[model samples]
Target: TATGKGFTPAFVQASRGWTAGQWAEARDRLRARGLLDADGELTEDGVRLRRDVEEATDRLDHAPYEHLGQAGVERLTELAGAFTATALGNGAFPVEHFGKG
Candidate 1:
């Protein structure tokens, strides 16, 4: 996930696998589909839709293993922080965004 107020489409596109042109094209398609705003930010409805999709994905990712409880949640949170550090090259936890505190 992105940190802080975040950056422009250039930054986001660079982070993903798509080239700038491909990113632009895909972004246009998404905007046309009402998934993004004219400026490329997510619209209010898009925000809720994305949140629901993310929740569903999270549930699916956690559903396969049984017997996971509070302890498992804590462990997964820690592991997620570690994963963000290793994968993103940033060691700090974006607690302000994730509401961990």
Candidate 2:
């Protein structure tokens, strides 16, 4: 089920369920639309558009929470790092050694 790396057959199968021709047609349509280049990379316009979208989303949706101070930020950062390490560690990070209150 390999459609040559980066292109996952599982993702394609889930989306189209058995249509290489359909996928190719849709892919070609995207290339025609100037969103994807022939080499499968996003066109310059597509990259700029995606960046614009992300920047606009951040500008419109995210704001600095003014309530937290420097000390609070430091405490939160430590807790977040410990939590993430504990959850995702492969015996590499030892959160318990840091001790808990």
Candidate 3:
């Protein structure tokens, strides 16, 4: 899905700590399922699947944030923002691959 979203395989593998063989197998499976192309680009089905998965994840993850309440959530976000920026500046993750969300 990261590849589908324009992230390079090397970046994904490095960031996720996936062995080359493991990444290859996953890529092959996605391609066989018609979710990815031979070049690793995502098909429309892949895009939809990624979106659904992300939505489901967000829904499940929201409970803790809800428990924190709006102000708490805002404060958490503010606190994290600086750390995130520092990580970005330090090349903890590729800035180009990081989305605003």
Which structure among the candidates has the greatest lDDT? Answer: 3
Instruction: lDDT winner between 1 and 3, please give it.
Output: 3
Model 2, runs deviating above 4 Å: 1-26, 63-80, 87-101
Give the alpha carbon lDDT tens digit for every residue of 13-62 in model 3.
87899999999899899888999987777789988899999899988998
Best by TM-score: 3
Give lDDT tens digits, candidate 1, residues 4-101. Answer: 14444445555566797897788788788787887777777777777898889899886644567778878878998888779657734343333322
TM-score of 1: 0.57
lDDT of every model, 2 decimals: 0.65, 0.62, 0.80
List per-candidate RMSD values in Å. 6.0, 10.5, 3.1
CA lDDT of 58 in candidate 2?
84
lDDT of 2 by residue, 1-101 (tens): 11322445445455558677777787688678887788766788767766787789887753442357678778878999998888767654233432221
Candidate order, TM-score descending: 3, 1, 2
Residue 79 error for model 1, in Å?
A: 6.3
